[model samples]
Structures are given as structure tokens and as C-alpha cells.
Target: MKIYEITFSPTGGTKKVADSLSNELGRDITGVDLSDNNEDLHEFSLKNEDIAIIAVPSYSGRVPATAAERISRIQGNGAKAIIVCVYGNRAYEDTLVELQDIVQKNGFLVVAAVAAIAEHSIAHKYAKDRPDKDDNRLLKEFAAKINEKLKKKDFSTPEIPGNRPYRKAGNAGIVPKPTKACTQCGLCASRCPVGAIDKNNPAKVNRKACISCMRCVSVCPHQARKINGLLLAIVNMMLKKACSIRKECELYI
Candidate 1:
């Protein structure tokens, strides 16, 4: 059976967790990056025999709207799906359940769910260097168990947690802008998930369209993209208490 690693990870932390899970889940695992802004988001359909491990980082406790919108376009065609929601150490409140709902609506059979933690995308100090050795061991164990479940023909939908009307997603939190050091190389513009950065002049940013996923900040080769230092300091203070404590990955089958 083919395993599809479908994820929307902007800053790479969530992708790392999804990669570890996919690597152990099976051989011939294919990747479908939900972050690719240039792709035609709606072109794939999975066979019933296929398994899709759909993962997305929690954006303010919900699936990022861009991710949810792009992901909704793919037709699952009754494929078995192991839905995963990766979040910073803070919290994933409704992300996993919300994502499972989406894949199911797209015709996937929900077999299992995982809520995992990675480093904070915006404020890197939290859950730093995650999906480390111990995290990989746990992820592999989860993969093994999921494999065992797949062996059985039964495909009952698993119960996932969340409310019918998810909590409101917060406003764009940390929009990054290119610094004077920016060379208008367009890498950040090309890579912005929502096309928030101006293509011709890479330093120009449209904050209204920005999701603040930090792709520009993380992808900049010259480290020219950045958030306001004062804002970052405030965010650090706001999240410090919620992020300092270690959190473990949770699985629901």
C-alpha cells in the first residue's frame, strides 16, 4: 500500500515530525507538500488501498486556514488516513479534530489520529530541537501500531476530539518583513504561502494577506527576513510560561 505524507508545514518543524512518522509507517511513502503556493492544490485522488498521513501545524489552535483550504481540494476516495496535527509546545486545542473532519469530508476513512509537538515556528525557544531521538522512537512506535491496524480489513472511523464550531482562529500574529539586506532575490516572495511578499520588490510585504507562518523568515538565505524585535519580545514574554514545560505526543486510535 502506498503511504502519502501530506503536510502543510511552513517553518520545517512540523514537516520533520511528519517525515519521521512517514519514514517508519511504510516504504514507498509519497510526499504532498500543502505549503506549495504555486501548485494546483486540487489535482490528486487516492485509491482506497492507499493510506494518507495528513499533517498540519496548528495555527493558533486551529488548522491554518490556508492549509485547510488547500487540503480540502484533494479527494481522498475512501483512502485510510492517519490525521496528524503538530503544534508548538504551547497547545493544539482543536487542530487534530478539525483536520480529521476535513479529510473525512474529502472522503477519507479516519483510522487514527496523532497530536504531536515540534518547535515553535515563530518563537523558536519553545520545544526547541524537537522530533529528537526520543521523539523519533515514539513516532516509530506509533507507526508500527498503525501498520498493525492497517493489516485488519475493518475501517471504522475513530473518534477524534474538538467542538462542532471550532474556536475562532486568532489574527495574524507575527508577520515578517525583508530587511534592508534583502536583495529582491524573490525567494521569499516565491515561497510565501499566501503570496504576501511582493515578487518584484521582495522587501515589500502585504501584511493583510500574510498568515505569519514565518516561511519568509525561515527560508531567507541571507537571514534578511525578520519580525519586529519589540513584537518578538512581547511574544516571547507571552508564550514563555505556556511553552517552558515539556509536552509529549498524544495518539488516539
Candidate 2:
């Protein structure tokens, strides 16, 4: 049986958790990057003997549209799947349920689910240094349980959390603007998941198109991109209380 590590991690935190769990799950693993805009997601297919670990970062407590859309294109062919939603300390309200639905609709049979905490992509203060030692241990345990289930031929779907009609996604208007330090390297444009940045003019961004995933900000080699100070401060204040107390990883099997 093959193990597929399918993920959409814009800022690396989600991928970190996914990779750790996958390492514990199996030795032979194949990666399917849902964040790559140029790839044809429909080309990927799986058989009943395959296992797919579909992981994505929770954006405002919901699955990112790009991830969701890409995930729906893959042909699961009744392969067993483990759904994982990584959040930034805050609750991942409907992300798990929504992701389960998407993958199941595409013919995956979800056998397990996980909700994990990672550092906030925007506000780095919350859940800092996460997917750390403790998280990895817990994930390893989860992987063992999943392997047991598979051995038992338990393909029953786990009860995933979240509402059917997901909460309305809040406006993600924190577009990163290139600072004077920007050299118009076009790296930001090339790496943008949504094609929000202009390739010719790195400074130019389509605000309407930007999902505010901060891929450009995180990938900037020169540290040239930045969000507005006042806006970032306001966001930090709003998330302070929710992110103050540390949250732990959760598993459903």
C-alpha cells in the first residue's frame, strides 16, 4: 500500500505537522502539493489499497479555497484517508468537517481525523515553536493507532467536528506590500498561490485576488514584504486572548 502525503501548507507550519505524522505512518510516501497552482490535481489518483493523508492549514477556521478546490480534483477511488487540519492555536471551527466532506466526495474513505496547533501564520506570537517535541510524540501515537485500524480493516469514517454550513469566512485584507528593499525578484509572484502578485512588478498586487495567506511575506528572501503595522497590531490584539492559552493536538479514530 502506498502512502500519499497530500497537503496545502502556505507558510510551512501545516506541512511540518503533516510530514512528522507521515514519517511515523510509513517509509514509502509520495507527496501531493495542493498549493502548487500550476499542477494538474486531477491527474492524481489512488486505489483502494492506498492511504492518503490529506492535510491543510485552517484559514479563519475554514479550509482554504485553493486547497479545497485542488483536493476535490484528486481521484481517491475509495482509498482510506486521514484528514488533518492545522490551526494557529485558535479553533479550527469547520475546517476538519469541510475537508472530510471534500475528500469523501472525491471517493476517499476517511478512517481518522486530527486537529493540530501551529504558530499563527500572521501573528507569530501565538502557538510559537509548535509541532514541537510534544506535538510530534502525540502525532506518532496517532499514527500507530491509524496503522492498527488499517490492520483491522477498519475503514469506518471517524466522527469529524464542525458545522455543515461553515461559518462565513472573514475578510482577509492583510495584503503584504513590497518595501523599498524589494528588488523586483519576482519570487513573490512566482510563489503566490493565488497569482495575486504581479510578475513584472513585484510591488503591484491584486488586493481582490489576494487570499492573504502570507505566502509572499513568508517567502521573501530580502524580508522586503510587510503588512501594515496598525492593521497587524489590531489583529494581534484581537487574537491575543484566544491564542494566549496553549492548545493541544486532538485525534479521532
lDDT of 1 by residue, 81-136 (tens): 99999988899988888998888899999998988888888888888888778888
TM-scores for every candidate against the unseen true structure? 0.97, 0.98
Candidate 2: tens digits of C-alpha lDDT, residues 200-247? 999889999899898899999999999999999998999998989989
**Once superposed on the true structure, which residue ranges of model 2 sit more than 4 Å away at CA?**
none
Output the TM-score of candidate 1: 0.97
Q: What is every candidate's alpha-carbon RMSD to the true fold?
A: 1.1, 0.8
Error of 2 at 124 (Å): 0.3
Q: Which residue runs of candidate 1 sit more than 4 Å off their true CA positions?
A: none
Query: Could you tell me which residue pairs clash in candidate 1?
Result: none
